[model samples]
Target: MNLLINVFLLSVFFPYITVIKSLDTQPTALFLGTVLFLIYFKAEKKQNRYIFYILILSILSIFLFEKSNIMMSIRGILNYWSLGIISYVSYELFKRNKIKNSIIKRSINAWFILGFIQTFYSKYFFKFLIVGMRTSDDRGVTSFATEPTFYGIICIFFGILVIENFKKNDCILFFSNLLIQILFFSKSSMVVLFLLIWISLYILKNISLKAILFSSTSLVSFHFIIINFLKDTRVYKLYIKSSDLKKLFFEDHSLNMRLSHIFYSLKGALQNFLLPNGLTQWIEYVRIETLQKTYFHTLTPTTSARIMSGFGGIIYESGLIGIIFIGIIFFCLKKGLKNKEIAIFIIIISFSAIQPSFPLNGFILGMSIFNLEKRRIHKNEKIKSNDCCRN
Candidate 1:
């Protein structure tokens, strides 16, 4: 209960982000220096030592490879500690425990009220909190979150919790939250749409394999057909004007940026393939900056241009080893991997894949899914055991 409160209220409310403005690359660090000091010592119970092992493996990566700018790499680790560790610990606390319906109701109510404030969203609204939660942003409605994408993830997390609680009022709140997300026009609006459709499909139980294949095929075909039609008509030109939005709707920036990040990252990996630079974009930027510093006197450039892509960032930071390290966690998670596991993976990846920096967020989201699946399996096991004894 304390852990839950810490997560929903303390961690979310008091992210207390500190930004280091550097020409190489700015480090946007989220750490609570003193807010959760009261609850810091309370050790959380863990059913499995999964996260501990993952952390250990992360530490081992540094020793296995060239530790360039070790302090900066340590900061990357600190980021993982801040976001991943806290999220995983909170998930573990909730996994075996029953989240009270009252808590769910209150949370939903809070989200609903917060969503309402977002309708009047603007920079001014975002500047001053109408309530305890946030309001708007230049990007979109943030509403208790620092960013629209983050807010959308939180909303979906709340939706999942609401459904798991099996409350009718909470169901209404979830849908209403989705409506608010749509109103916000967020980059993460895609996640909201996908979750809504997929979760709603729960009503149609036991879909045949043929039906599933046909439905998926038709959806893809129709999506492309519409894209082509839009191209012909140039309707999208009118609707989706922003270049970033244009990437999602019609076109994307040159793959060169993504390629450079990936290629250089892999090259860095080759130097110490066992481990690479820590997964921080700033590391890549800083690395180039260092070379530029050394060659400042020479009328020569030392670095190639780089762009931030999520997949590229993973390769650049953690390398082949880091990929496998994270992969192993998922591999071990097969024990409780559910039928909808692929869908969940797709949804989370879809949100992350488009972003600049995603590893920390991905870790938190991935662990959340892992814990939810674990709880589900436990619930099923309990039911099966009870039935066998009753018989």
Candidate 2:
């Protein structure tokens, strides 16, 4: 409950903070400080090799760069890494019985409920809170993202939660979340939602000609009903413009812009392939003043570019050796994908392309997937052992 409340407050009030900023440094600092204090007082074995390595890498990277901006960027990266550590630790705590699954479920429910209400307030009620708050541009939309992309990502997460819960037969939770996502009217989100649903159906072996026909008919009917009833409203207009059927596969300027941006990012990556710099430096060189400006002007770099930039920064600071080591780590991770941890690591990397950078959310998600894989492995091993004993 406490964790959920904290997340809700952060989401509602500090929406501008990137997930790394919110989940990594602050929470990690507090957690570590308390743990250290406890260790000192109780004479507990406070050994955490991962945390030690993370801290050392972060500090060493800062000194290696010796550039204030690069150091700052490294700090940001460390913050994000810290969040991942925190999430993993939290998951471990749950796995070790320090926390209950029921608690986690309840927390998730609370978060969804809070998110739904806050989004509603932002859409409807917040206008009258302040004199200048009612402007169309400022009226309760994502203040953090310069464009709607971030909201789209959030919608994707929400949609994932909805689908996952729905598969578990939590219909009310699923529908509630779906409604919230619909209200956001994000094109990227709609596309992701469709993809997720389709993939899930395929995975479940529930996809069929009849199912497809029924889904198509239902979607078309829903579209007609929406257009007939809400055509004149702003929400309707936004929905029509952002709908997956209309924008993703049909015609949409925003989608075109994103496609173009992807090209530019790839170009940038190729140009800076050997000597990548940090994203902050690239932004500075590009004279991108703010998040909104960068997004609106299509100046945001691509995921490949960003990773290359980070690699480049390392090279600049620590030379080819550092880059080589990092590359090796990545290579090993790729090679080990059959291992659950590696698969989760890959998903985290893939998700980073869609998100701004690797943040707490990505970290937690990676850890969760990794843990799930571990559990499956354990169960499989147990089953095999049992079968052998019986034989």
Candidate 3:
């Protein structure tokens, strides 16, 4: 089980999969991992029984509704069913093996090295460029991914692993981590935001109130510096021209594209709460003026027309039912979390609100870490009670 789990992790984190397009419809990691794990470890049957059945039934519902659109069904399977099962399997396997500090550190190193290699390869050999970002923009390194944002997400997850090891306070590793983000030119704001959260938490934990005050003041001043500096950059050119708050958010090309999709998704969710269209579903049933703009679709994964509705996509794709399933999993994970673990969750969620899909990798990592903390706290409490009885 441990060896298979490691291979599964490699398939997810490594750049071995040559066919990126197949990922849209196939469960590359999930399918392969399931086969490997099934060969060795008997699948956990007791706890996951109800959820597994529910998941299977929900997937079959799509086939009943529309058999012609098998592609969308495939997308639904890979995204919802396969990802859910495989992630849990990863979590369980991780627990069974007693996930170690060494394993976490080694995984972080793999993510960083694989990311760097894939970025250069994508830029020079594959030319996997996004719509708004240009070839010379220096932000076009997507690694093995078809999009830079996804690459950014992978980097951000690695950053979380680094934070797990951040207690060491390695200055060189810290700077190098930041440098990697700069090279990737990942559009996702998670890199900076996550780093800030780590720094803030570390200070609050280890440093004095005076140091916290100093850091807070520095961050506030840095905000001003960034505002002034960004107004001059190409990315914020539209912001400089538009003084009106409405125009600033609604008219900007980059911002508005995402904003429009989010709006469409919300409206669609309200209108089609029970049977919302899954991914790649562009049915004419949805009648909204704004949603028409989201219709453009090419075969490529990073195409400008890809359905990117942040949380809205969840509601739009599987309706309230899907949201309920996710909520159940979330609350279940939360039951074992400690106060510090909850604080860490708030940080990841802040970025998750804007990301196209739920940050599942981050969720899995957080839950596993929190479970470990819960056990440690339990053991400490038991020890204290034993000492009191002895006294």
- Reference-based lDDT, each prediction: 0.45, 0.41, 0.49
lDDT of 1 by residue, 1-391 (tens): 4554445433332231213322111222223311332243245444345555554654464453336555655655553344344445344435535335565556555645654565444433443432333333323455555555555655555555544445577577665665455334332433444553554454344467765775676456534543553342222332344446534333422222333444455556666654565544444454554464331221112333232344444455666766665564455443333434433443334323333222224334434455556776789999999999999
Clashes of each: 0, 1, 2
- Model 2: runs farther than 4 Å from truth? 1-75, 79-83, 97-152, 162-167, 184-207, 210-218, 225-261, 284-360, 363-373, 376-380, 383-391
TM-score winner among the candidates? 3
Per residue, candidate 3 scores C-alpha lDDT tens digits across 1-391 of: 5576565665555422344544422245666656754643365554443234434634543542456666665554555545454545555555465445565556555545545664555454433322222233423455444455555556655554455434556524753664455333443333444545656765766588887886787567545643664343333444345568565665445555555555666676677655757665534433334344443221122333444544466667767765675554455444534334434554344324333223334235334444654576799999999999999
* Winner on lDDT (1 vs 2): 1
- Poorest stretch of ten by lDDT in candidate 2: 126-135
Q: For residues 1-391, could you state the per-residue lDDT of candidate 2 as single tens digits?
A: 4464345324422233333432211333323423433433254254333333433443454433435566556654553344334434443343444443343345345434544554556533332222122224322243233223344444444444344324455646554554444434322333433443544444345468876776676567556645674355443555566646534433444444444444443344456654444435544433432244433344444422243233333443344444553443354333423333332333332323343122334233433433454556789999999999999
The lDDT leader among the candidates is 3
- Candidate with better lDDT, 2 vs 3: 3
What TM-score does each of the candidates earn? 0.57, 0.54, 0.67
Error of 1 at 125 (Å): 1.0
lDDT of the structure predicted as candidate 3: 0.49
